[model samples]
Target: MEATLSLTDKSGVADVRRRAIHMAQALGLSEKLQADAALIVTEAATNIIKYAGQGEITLKSFLEGASQGLEIIALDRGPGITNLASARTDGYSTGGSLGAGLGTIARHSALFDIYSVPGNGTALLARIADSRDGALNGFQIGAKSTPKPGQAVCGDAWGVRQIGTHLWIALLDGLGHGPLAAEAANRAVSIFLLAELSDKPADVLRRVHQGIKTTRGAVMAVALFDTDKRMMSFAGVGNIVGIVSSGSETEHLISTDGTVGYNMRTVRPSDVAWSKGSVFIATTDGLSTRWNLNRHPGLTDRHPSLIANVLYRDFARDADDATIIVVKAT
Candidate 1:
C-alpha cells in the first residue's frame, strides 16, 4: 500500500511520523523498525522545509513472498543539492547545523539514492527491507539526459534486470503529476528491483497492482528480452506505450487491458517477438500519439537518454507527467 503526505511546516513532520507509525503498525513492522523509519522521515521532511521551502513525501510498502519493506521518497523543486559530497558528510550542512541529513538517511535505510542538479531540484529515495533474506537488484539503467527549458518530467519510470541470460525491462507512469506522481513512479521501480527474478511479467504486474492499492494506480508495461530465443515478451496495462524498433521498421506493444493497482480484474499479459538491431521505448501519455513508428526512424541508434530527450522534445505535452524508458539490444 502507498500513502502520500505533504510537508509544508513543522506539523507536516508530525503528520509523516504518524503516518509512518500507522503503516508500520498495520504492516507489523517491529517497534525498532517503526521508530527508525519515523525518525528518518522526520529528518527528511525537515530538510525539505529548511532547504526547499516546501516539499512532498510518499511512503509505500512492498511485499513479495516472504520479503517485505517500505520505500520513502522526498521531493522538491527548491534549490537543488549544492554539494552532494559535502552534503553527505557527517558534519556538513548548508543551514549551519550538523550536516547529518544524508548520512542519517543512509544509516537508517537499507538503500538510499539521491539525484539532484544545481538549478533543477532534488529527489531523495530510501528503502528499508524487512528481512535480511531479500537482495537488491539494480535496474539496467542507461544514461541521464538534460531536460529542455520549460519541460517538466511526467514521472515515467523504468528498470532492467538480468536473470540468467534473459533481460527484463519494465516501465511505469504514476497517476497525476508533481511529487505524488514521482513517489508512485519511484515505488514502482523499487518494487521491480526487489521482486523475485522468477516471477512472470503478469505476476509481477499483479503484485505491483496489489502493492499500490492505497494510492493512485499507475500504467505499467514489462518486457523480457530472451537472447537465446531471440524473442521479446511483453505485458502491459493502462496507457503506457512500448515500441520495438528494428533496422528498418518499428512495432508497438499493446497492453492487456485495465490499469495497475485498481480495476485489475480486466488486466492481462501480452507478448511479442524480438531480435538484434532492435530497441524498445516505453513512455507515458504525455507523448502525443500523433508521432508513430514511421516518423521516429533510427531513434534507437542514439543513446537511451537521447531517445527519451528526442521524444520529450518532439511530442510531450505540458499537461501531465511524461516519462520514457528506452532499451536497445547491442
Candidate 2:
C-alpha cells in the first residue's frame, strides 16, 4: 500500500507520474482524479529536480469508510523555500518556470499542507480522497508505515477507531521483520477492529493478545482519547514510544518491558491531561527516539501528515519496519 521513489533528475518524472496514475486506477478513483494525480506528481517531481536537485516521493493509499484516498508526500533538502507564502501563491515562482504548480496542486487536493524552513528542508503533503464526504470531523491524523529497505512486507501496523466521543489509537511492531511478523501485526489489528465489547485500551489489548497467540507476537501500545474530558489513557508494552507535545513541553508515555502475546505483565492504563492544539505521536522502534519538534520550526502547526513525513524522513533508522502515527487534538 506504499511506494517510495527517489527523484534526482528530470528523467525520473515520467516514472513517478506513471506510478501515480496506475495507483489512482488501482484505487478505483475517477478518470478526472487519475489525471489530477498525474498533474500533482508531475509538478512535485519537477519542483524537486529544479529546486533541491534531489528528493523523495512517498505514495500511500488509505481507506476512509467506503471511499479510498491516495496521499503523496514530497520531501526535499534543497535550499528551503525562503518565502513559502509567496511560493504557494498562483503566480509566483523562483525556479523561472510557471508559478501555477502549488495552486493547482492545492486546488485538486482534498487535503493539502506544507512545511519549510529557509535552511532546513521542505515537506509537502497532498491527499486526494475518492470522496471527502466520508471523512469524520473533529481531529486529524498522519501516519507512515514502511517496511525495511529490502523486505517485501512491513512487520508494523496501526489503526484508529471511534467510540462515542472517544478515539482509540493503536500501534504495533511485530516481533521481527518479513512475512511472519507481518502476519502477527495484521492478526492483531483484525482482533482490534472486531472485538465486541469494551472500549477500554487495556480490555481491547487483552482481546488482541489472546487472538494473536498463534503468531509471532508484537510490541504494542494503545491510547484512548476522550475529547470532552480532555484526557488520554495510555497502555502499552515493549519499546513502542508514545509522546505528547505542545510548544517546548513534552511527556513520554510509560510502558512495561514485555512482548505482547509471548510474555505477560501488568497492563495498566494511565491517564494524562490532554489539551487543545497538542499532538500525540506513537512510533515503532524502527525510528530513532531522539527526535524533538522544537528543532523543526512551524512543523507543529502543519497537517499531521506533513509532520509525520518530516519526522520519518529525518529520524528513520532504515534497518527495520517503521510505523509512525501523528494525531492532533482539535
Candidate 3:
C-alpha cells in the first residue's frame, strides 16, 4: 500500500506517526518495530514542520524476495542544509531542538539516503525491513506524480512487475484531467498489475487496450526488459515519451498515435539494447518535450528516486497531471 501526507504544521507530525503505525500494523510488523517506525516518522515530520515550514511524506510497501519492509520518502522546498555531514551528527541542533533526528533515522533503517542543496531543498529516503541479514532482491523503480491544480486525484498512473530476469514497466495518461481521467489511468494500472509478467510489451498494451475499452481511454507506454538477454522491448501509443540512455548515447523510443481503447493503430515493439549502466525513463505529456539531460549534468548518476523528483521539480507542467518514472539497468 502507498499513502501520502502533507506536513505543514505541528499537527502533521502526529498524523505521520499515526499513519506510520497503521502501515506497520498492516504489514504484520511487531509492536516494537511499529513503535520504532512511528518514532522515526515523528522525528522526520517534526523537523519538516519546524524548519521547512512545509513538506510531504510518502509511505509505501516494498518487497525483496521473502523480506518485506516500509519505505518512507520526505520531500521539502525550504531553505536547504548547507552541510549534510554536520547535519547528520548527533546533538547538532539547527532548529533549537535535539539534533539526533537524522542519525537516529539512519540507525533504525536498513537503507538510508539524504540529498540536499543549499537552494534546491532536500529529499530523504529511508527503508526498514524485517530481514536482519541485510539482503534485498529487486531492481530500483522510482516515480513521482501530482494532480493538476484544483484536482482531487492525478490522472496519470504507473506500474511495474518483475519476475526472474524480466521486468515490465507501464505509464498511463488518461485523455484529460479530473476524476474521469483518473479512472481511466487507474484502470490501466490495475490491468498492468494483473497481466502476466511474461507478456511482451506490445501484447501487454494490446490486452490493456481491450480491458479498458469502457473507460475514457488513455495514452500508454510499456517497456519490457530481459536482463538475461541484455535487451529491452518497448511499445507505446499516443503522446507518452520513452527514453533509453545506453551510456554512450541516448535513444528515443517512439510511440504511435491514437489513444488506447479508443483509436490505437497497429502496435509493434521496438527492441533496444540494455546493460548495467543503461537508464530508462517514461513521462506523461504534463512535462515539456524539451527536457534535456545536458542541462542537468551528473543527474543520471543519482538514485532513481532523486532523478525522478528532480525531473518533476524542473519540468512538470502546471495545467495537467504530471508524472515521470526512472529505472536504471542493474
Candidate 4:
C-alpha cells in the first residue's frame, strides 16, 4: 500500500507520521524499528513544512531481495539547499532548533539519498528495512505516478517483478483519465503480476493486451532482463517512451504506433546488451520525450524513485496522467 500526504502544516506532519507507523506495523517491523520509521517520517515532513512551506510525503512498502521495508519519499518545491554537506551536519539549523532532521533520517535508514539544487528543489529518499543491511541484491526499481489535475486517482500504473537476475517491468497508461482509465491501467498491472515469469517481454505484453481487452485500452511498454544471458528484451506499443542509459550514453527504445487492447499491431521485441550499472526508464507520453538526463548530472546514480520524481517534476505534461518507471541493472 502507498499513501501520499501533503505537508502544509504541523497537522500534516503528524498525519504523515501516523501513516508511516501504520505502514511499518503492516510490514511487521518491530516496535523499535517502527518508532524509528515514525521519527524519520516526522523529521522529513517537518523539514518540508519548516523550510519549503509546502511539499508532500509519500510512503510505500517495498521488498527487494530478502529485505522487506518501507520507503519514504519527501519532495518540496521550496528553495533548495545551497550547502547540502553543511546541512547534513548535526545541530545545523536553517529553521531554528537543533538541526538533526536530515542527519537523523540518514542514520536510521538502511539506504539514504538526497538530491537538491540551489534553485530547482529537493527530493529525498529514505529506505528503512525490517532487518539490517537491506539492499536490493541484484536489481533496483523506481516508479512514480501522478493523477491528472482535479482527479483523485491517476490513470497511469506500473509494476515490477524481480526474481534473482530476471526482472520484468510494465508501464501502462490507460486510454484516458478518471476511474475508467484507472481501471484499465490497474487491470494491466494485475495481469503483469500474475503472468508467467518464463515468458519474454513481448509474450507478457501479448498477455496484457488480451487481459485488458474489456477496458478502454492503454498504451504500454514492457522490459525483460535476463542476467544469465546479459541481455534485455524490450517491447512497447503506442507512445510510452523507454530508454536505456549508462554513464553519458542513452539508447531510445522504439515502439509500434498502436495501443494495447485496441488495434494493436504485431509485437516486435528488441534485444540490447545489459551492461552493469545501466539504467532503463519508461514513461507515458504525459512527460515530454524531449528531456535530457545530461542536464541533471549525477541524478541517474540516485535511488530509482528520486530519478522518476525528478523527471516527473521537470518534464511532466500535467494536463494528463503521468507515470515513470526506472530500473537499474545491478
Candidate 5:
C-alpha cells in the first residue's frame, strides 16, 4: 500500500524509471498508461537532478475492492522554483532545453499539483487512476506554521470550513522566522478565514498565494475532512508535513515542491481519501521528521495548539521556527 524511493544520484534516476515501470505493469495499467507514467517519472527525476541536485520519491497505492490507483510524490530541498508560471509554460526553462517539465507531467497524470518557494523547497504530487471505481472524491489535507518560544504570536493562522457535514482546515508557516513568518502565516489564515466560507481548497490556496505576493511567502497545507464520505483531502507546499494516524499505524506526508511567494505560480493540488479512525497532523520543518512517533502516541489526540507546543517542546531543532496543527475525526 505504501512504498518509498530515493533519487540521490545519477543511477537513481534510471532505477526510479525501471521501478515505476515495474509497478505500473504489476498494477495492470494499460500499456499506454504504463508508458505515460514511466515517461513522467523519468521527466520528474530529471527535473530533480537539474533543479534540486538531490531528491526522494514516494509511491503509494490504494485499492478499495476492485479499484486501484497510485499517488506519486517527489520531494526536494533545493534552490526552489523562482517562476512557476514560466516554468510550467510550454518553453520555459532555466537550463534552456525546452522548459516543459511541469507541463508534461500535468498532461500525463489524471491529477497533478506543484508547490514551491524561493530559498525554501519544492513538492510535486501526481495521481493516476486505473479505473473509474478507483477515483475518490473524498479529501486530502495538511497544515504547517511557526511557533516561537515567547513571542506575542502576531502572525499565527488557522481556519475551518464546512461543506454539508464535511469540514476543512488550513494552517500556514510564513517565510523567515519570528514576526515575519508569523505575519505571513497570519495573512494566510486571514485569507482562509474569508475564503473558506464558500470556496474550494484549491481556490483558497490560489488566493493565499496571490495575497502573499507583496509580503514574504509562506508554506501552507489545506485539509478537507468529509464526514459523509469519511475521507480527508489535502494539498501543501514548502516545509509543511502532514501525517495520518489510524490506530497504531501512522503515515507521514512530506511536501512535493516548494513554498509560496516570490516565484510560485498557481499550483494544482492533490487529494487523498482518508479511512476511518485516521488522525491528521501538519507542521513546519522546524519539527524534525526524525522525531519518534512511537514514543509520542498521544500526539494524535491532542488539540492543534497543544500539538504544536508538544512538537516544539520535544523535537524543535531551535535553530528554526516551529508550528503544528492536529485534527482527528471521531
Candidate 6:
C-alpha cells in the first residue's frame, strides 16, 4: 500500500498520522511499531507545517531483504536547513515548538536519511522494520513509484528476483496513466515472477511481450546483475532510461525504440563491467532527462533509497506515472 498525502496545515498532520497508522496495521507491524510510525510521520508533518509551510508525506509498504514494513519520504520546498547536523540533535528547535524531530525519528527507524540544500529544499527518508524481521541482506535496492496526480494506480511497475549473487531487476511503464495502463504493468510483473531464472534480458522481454499483449502494452527494461562476475546485462523496449555510474564517470544502457507486446523490434541486450561502489539506475520517462547527479555533492554515498528520493524530489515531471529503481551491487 502507498499514498502521497499533502500537508497544507496543522489539520493535515492528523490526517497523515492516521493514514500512517492504518498502513502500519495493514502491513502487520506490531503495536509498538505502529506507534513509532505514528510518531515519525506526525513529527515529519509538523515540521513541514511549522517550517516548509506546505509539503508532502508519502507512506509506502516495502519488502527489502528479509524485512517488511513502512517507508516514509517527506518533501518540502521551503527554506532549507542550513546546518543539518545541528538540527538532528534532540531538543533542538528553530521555531517555538517541541524539540522532538530528526533524532527521535532516527532512533525509531531502522534506516534514516536526509538530504537538503539551502533554498533548494529537503528530502528525508525513514524505514521502519516489522518486529519479526531485523536483518537485511542480498542486493541493496531502492525505488519510488508515484502515480499521476488524480490517479488511483500508477501505470509503472517493477519486480526484483535474486538467487545467490545473480540479481534480476525489471522496470515497466505501461502505455499511459490510470487503470488501462496499470493493467499492462501488473500483467507484465506476473509473467516476470514465473519466468525462468536463466532467462536473459531479451528472453524476459519477449516472454512479457507475449504475455501482456492483451493489455494496453508497455515499455519495459530488464537488467541482470551478476555480482560475482562483476557484469551487468540489460535489454529493453521504448524509452526507459538505464544508467551506470561510478565515481565521476557514467555509461548508458541501450534500449530499442519500440513498444513491447505491440510493435516490438528485435530484442538486443548490452553489458557493462561493474566497478567498486558502482550504482545502476533505471527510470521511466516521467522524469526530466536533464537531471545530473554532480549537482549534489556526497549524495552517491547515501542509501539507494535516499538517492532515488533526491532524484524524484528534484526532477519528477508531476504529469505522469513516475518510477525509479536504484540498485547497488553487494
Against the true structure, whose lDDT is highest? 6
| Candidate closest to the true structure, highest TM-score | 2
What is candidate 5's lDDT per residue for 1-330, written digit by digit as tens?
A: 445577777788888878777887777778887777777777777788878888877666645324566667776778778888877876566764335568877777766777655665566766666553432234333333434545545344666665556777887777766678777887888888787455666677788888988888887888777777666667777667777777777666645466676655555565555665466777666778676555544445533323443444457775566666666554
Task: Write the candidate numbers in order of decreasing lDDT.
Answer: 6, 4, 2, 3, 1, 5
The per-candidate count of clashes, in order, stands at 3, 0, 0, 0, 24, 0
lDDT of 1 by residue, 1-330 (tens): 777677778778889989988887788888888887887787788788888888778787854224577767777767777788878877567674335668877887765667665655566766666663333231123322222224354466777677666888788777766556657766877787777877778778888887887767788888877777778788888887778877776677788667677776555665556665577787777777665644444445654534554565457675665667776665
- TM-score of the candidate numbered 4? 0.89
Runs with alpha carbons beyond 4 Å of true place in candidate 4: 133-137, 150-153, 194-198
Between candidates 2 and 3, the TM-score winner: 2
RMSD of every prediction = 11.0, 2.0, 3.3, 2.4, 18.0, 2.1
Clashing residue pairs in candidate 3 (N, C-alpha, C atoms within 3 angstroms): none
lDDT of each: 0.69, 0.84, 0.82, 0.85, 0.66, 0.86
Across 1-330, the per-residue lDDT of candidate 3 in tens digits comes to 888899889888888989999998898888877877876787778778887899988898877445578878888887777887888886677787546657877888776777776776777877767774423133566788888978888999988887778888899999899988999998998888888766888888889899889999999999988888899899999998889887758999999998998998998779999888788988998998877676555567666767787777678888899899988865
Candidate 5 clashes: the total is 24
TM-score of each: 0.54, 0.93, 0.82, 0.89, 0.50, 0.92
Candidate 1: misplaced stretches above 4 Å? 64-66, 96-99, 132-222, 227-239, 242-281, 286-330
Candidate 1: lDDT of 147? 22
Q: After superposition, how far is residue 141 of candidate 5 from its true place, in Å?
A: 14
Cα RMSD for predicted model 5: 18.0
Query: In candidate 6, what residue range of length 10 has the lowest lDDT sum?
Result: 130-139
